[model samples]
Target: MSATAAPPRAAGRPRRTSVVRTELRRGVGPWAGAAVAVTLLVTMYAKAPAWQGRWTDATDTLHIATALLAGPLTLAAGCWQGGRDRRRGTLELLRSVPRGRLRRTLLAVAPSALWPVAGQLLATTVCLLATWPYVGGGRPYLELVAADAVALASLGTLGHLVGLLVPWRLTAPLLAVAGYVGLAVGTYTESPARWLSPAVEHASPWEEPVWWFAPASAVWTGGLALAALLAYAARPARLRLLALLPLAAAVAAAVPVLRLPAEGPWRPDPETTRLVCDDGAPGVCVNALDRALLPDISQALAPLNERLRGLPGAPARWVGGANAPGAGEIGLPDHTMDAVRGRLRNPDLYLNSAVQWLFSDICDSGGVTEADAERLADVHLAVSEWLAPTPEDYGVPVGPGAQRHLDALRAGSPAAQRDYLARYLVADRCDPEEVPVP
Candidate 1:
């Protein structure tokens, strides 16, 4: 090599690649890869089943898991790398390196960012695969993946910055964990803390983007990045505070532009109600008060009169006045009377399940008799059958488990109904007739 010859450049430009390599050497911790694999497996197990059914419900779980796992890990990695100079008492040595302070800082922190990027990529891939079978074209998946990637990158960057700024070894991990918790809580509470967390925007085809880049979140992340850069520069105290400008601007921007809704009582909106009615499985409807409330004999069946015109008949109409009360009799019709009001007085059946309580209430009140209950049951059964095709013997097949449920209502004891529900309603897979898991 000639004396005073300039270092060979890649593409005729002095290569920054070595800096990246150095950053990787210093920033990529020993445990990062192991943590990534563990996180991937856990996320896949939790999210892959969304394709089986209850797609929304399953995706929600995935969203939460991604945030919790990725968020804290990002912060931890950044903090670990940030403390290196202090731990080694090599801040002066680091300053002596032959590069601009900002460039050197970038190089030092760049490697740590790699792990978070990889982790986010893995999460996005898993989520896509889980959702792809159900989504038609690639557009929806692409949109979701793109949004997720941006959101996660911003989050990782923010965590990395915090790790650099905070000098305390133990305090960084605690802050990371606390930040994760606080962001989660803010989703439910709409508190100021939520501003710090990245808003994962998993938009479905029918819905609009959900805060893909909220101003506060963006500002916080950007501010963190700038602060880390300045810290690397070893800027004076006067300039250190300037690192906060982006964050302040972010908060200011969000105040008017973001306008997140306050947390409060949630009355069912028209769209939600329509979604429920349109998509609800036969015999399965969304209750305003609860996600899984189903209609049983007590709510609709018990209120009708036995003498109503269409007892045991199609398009049945009520003939007797509801005003004229009748005795609460139990069991099927007699030879003389075509229809009779039967009471479900089996206390054991009545107490074990929510459905039983509903049935008992109807029977106890001068509500509908057995004939009235039967008519309503039949209508629901027919609707359910049309919606979810199953075996005829089990009753109208409404999805996978509706038939079994209707059968239980027909002959199984209350205990049997409860046990039957446990099989699919709350278990690993969708019951078809079952509501979403809480």
Candidate 2:
């Protein structure tokens, strides 16, 4: 008697087969090893002294890289896993059944490529959380999550398409490497080129109309994803058309949504970037610092500006603190939190440490007693030197003679001091601002 065949599967109803699941489970081990290897590489590089706090700094960047890589790796793995059937000649047996190319490809691709995206997103969150305490926390954790989702979905589709395009074993890795290189080159390019990178723009701390970015990226990534998915569904033409999605997305994002009114004095001066502030800010205030401390800060800066003005070519006009309504403001980027933990442990690039270094030098001189006014002047000199603004630079007016004092400070070795002028020198005399009568 002839061998009996199995019943045909109903149209659009995929046959109940454990083959896809089993293949995915079996293929996961190697990919897991790859992920471990990548993690180790990042960990080793991050611990180097030169890159101190680098792991924290690079966390956001790493999240993007991980997302970008996940798609291709999963696709390759799926393809490799699916290829076994072809090598064994079981592909013909499977194809001979009721399921068409699309359903078969979906069954082959879904488990290997789609399932791993969840794991990637989870890993990204864990990595970011681990870096929070060390670095000033991750950059808005929510943004990272969304970016990862887009990256994984796009890559997964691309990988599946690649798998379908090249049924051969050797082609996937070579393609992956080439694709990675192309992505790297495109991402790092200047002006016109930066838009071409696979990575999305890092959001500005300022709240503006960034809604465009999400949709633009989605449309771009979605198109590619659809193309890739279609390729997996055995539609080559759709995959080719979708290949342009990234570029299209880049073009959309690169074009400014809201152009500045005009580049004139009346126009909003980017130089005077606005400070993040709260209500009843009795004076021009930065949210990053306390309103109560404004008086102390103003007094400390005033004498320094005067001493600097005495020098040749001192700034004709200098304003301390956040600008008044018409004037521009200077503060840290909007991303900086009011409460920064380890930030204090870091060096003070601007004021306190600089003052301390100069005061230390003044103290080292034998038989020279330094008064509060003298110390203030010396620290002021140190600051001018550090600022080192070019001709016509905005800031405190420092003349030529003061520049000489600054030159001396730069040449000398300075001690590590935290509260150079503001806290230590006049803490007792400094008057704190009282809460205003509401």
Candidate 3:
């Protein structure tokens, strides 16, 4: 003790800060923080281009990145760190120290609990910065970032609990594998029960952007972490039952989210859905999420719009939601932010496919007969050829049948082909066979 400092109030009763500091010293020795950092870097490295080249949407990228980097790997690290004292024959010594087991365990798990979250947040900060230029046009959804962080922290704490209970050498790796598989399968399933899993849900149109759903996951996971902490810390058999209160609370909070039909924690963002129009006719408007893509999308669509000018049944105003009231409204390309690669793999081609959807009598589905299926396919092919003449245009694909029809259309007078396209587009129903592939 320093010469000026007073003695402790009682033996075994060290200052609270000193206790936490001691735990940090012990927990950090295992290099848990470094492990978290390394895991994040290794995982995000492969998707480096996603930060700028493709997905450029910071929040969207974080959603997937957290799923892969934040939780499972940190859990593995936590498992190893939690068991260190026991493995080194220090647990009983630590327990004998002057302090309640609750305070001691809390201090001990703090580093294990926090390093993973710190790593996630740090990596996320880097990714979020890349979206700065897009800030005015569209903002990243950060609620998801917080939710995922809570989930990772919970996993970290739970891993520690597992380690204390099972001190085997293989515990760390097994927990890591289990964590990854649980998250992967939980996200993959359509079941609502699995919806309670820590990963972010897939973004969907049916679900609007609602704030509560995101944090509810945090509430649920945070409860689990706290419960695990209490159960592991307390020596009295009855105190462990108190852990059930938080667990029950967690289930209560998760019910509303799990009951949701689609994979969701979102509802529509009206501000996001608010249309931002491009310069002129045939007019094009994009939703806020895709607003940054508008400049490029507008430029890409220019040739198509120019060809469509002054034609009957051609779209007058292009709306992005993919719903056209009549021939006057066309659905401009809305880039779906799937978890994969953070963006559609091929924007132009996917957009071209949207155009094909617009012209179809059925618009891409419904129990159709064999003859109708063949017919609709032919009509879609012809429409696709007309809209995107070259498959090379921004990666738009032209199938064999479509390419043959496109070649035939190109051979004909431009006026005649345009007239054919105009008629085909507005048709309520055409037997696909009735519509010439050419």
Candidate 4:
């Protein structure tokens, strides 16, 4: 019979669906994925900042740390995977039997490229889930997650290409150490490259991860990743030159971030400045960041509110600010535990902050006579002690002069002391320099 036309497909050809699985079974395995997961989790814990009361914060921090810590390991894994054939002395044998050289090269590279990303993403996903019960606002910025994955994937490909070029056993470890140093230097220096290190970003009351960074970082790293993957998989020497096109593209994409000034990868979200209010008197408003803190804050301030119940010009609301809080307004700490992280780790500071806010610049009455200012200054500690008589302020080490004044105030009728205290508080507006005690 006449030879029939060759069948449209070959039965022995490796199916695309099986490539990753085949690579995993033959070379890559759960160990690499597990190592990645453990390393990322450890990094997250070791440098983990106090939780910023936002879901976006939890997710970004996990992935940012994963991006930083997993990078070198991914590079090592890639190097190890890329040199496998050379290490086993099977490169010639594999070349002879391959369905195609590019396909074979891809088969070698696929596992290293994809596995670490999967592991890091899994770790980040687990972290995001942990925040579900506590963090209520903001969606998981999956864009940042995607950027982290691409950055890691690209790192893997670059390392793999480096391994293929230099097949020594030391190549992998040395490359990892070099990668780690590069990361470290990037963090400590002034070059634009430093921002590229995806280490954890501290959140502020006014800002969050910038919206555009997701796309910018993805494009930058993805381009470089494509270039390296193409360079590694290219069968013909001439085709390797094509890698430069993507490399150049990556360089171009990085310019905007590189040019950015030192202050931020975040922009102030207007929502953070809007007032969030509580139910009753001595009203309180916190920025979006501190809204979660409002209940605790209000309850803490209840006693102070009671003291101000009938007083003129007593602050009616407390808000986050450096100043310019309206009249009868109190400004929270400039550091404002508003951005206080991690399970209110600084609650004592928050309380101290509240007390400080009310007492801040209390002696600055603009119209006071010099003599009145001097008189006001004399009793300043007395007024401050009344605001918060905590041990730190009223206890030992206070000067004898201040102690005598405090004792005198305490010695007088409680009624007279209250009358004097009330007079001083209102005097900032009405009588610029009246003292608070008898």
User: Of the candidates shown, which would achieve the greatest TM-score relative to the real structure?
Assistant: 4
Runs of candidate 4 with Cα error greater than 4 angstroms are 1-15, 46-49, 189-193, 197-205, 259-265, 321-324, 334-349, 362-378, 391-418, 427-433
Question: What C-alpha RMSD separates each model from the true structure?
Answer: 14.9, 13.1, 5.9, 4.9
Candidate 2 deviant stretches above 4 angstroms: 1-23, 29-63, 67-79, 131-144, 190-196, 200-209, 231-342, 347-438
The TM-score obtained by model 3 is 0.75
Q: Which model is ahead, 1 or 4, in terms of TM-score?
A: 4
Candidate 3 error regions (>4 Å): 1-19, 28-30, 48-57, 135-138, 205-209, 235-241, 262-264, 322-327, 333-388, 391-438
Worst 10 residues of 4 by lDDT: 335-344
Give the C-alpha lDDT of model 2: 0.44
lDDT, residue 413, model 2: 48
Stretches > 4 Å off in candidate 1: 1-14, 29-34, 51-60, 136-169, 190-196, 199-206, 210-220, 224-245, 256-258, 262-438
lDDT of 4 by residue, 64-137 (tens): 56655688888888888888878889889988974676677777777777888888888887776666655534
Give the per-residue lDDT digits (tens) of candidate 2, residues 1-438.
Answer: 446977667787644665565645654434633563365346434532321222323444554455346545554555565555656667668778776676676666665555555566555555545544543211343543465566555665566556555678886676656666665566554454343344533322222223444455455555556555654454445554553565565445445422312221122223223443322212224322223333333343344443343333232332232343333222221212211332322222333322332233222343334554454454455454553322343245666655665665455443312223223233322112211100
**What is the Å distance of residue 19 in model 1 from its true position?**
1.5
Candidate ordering by TM-score (highest first): 4, 3, 1, 2
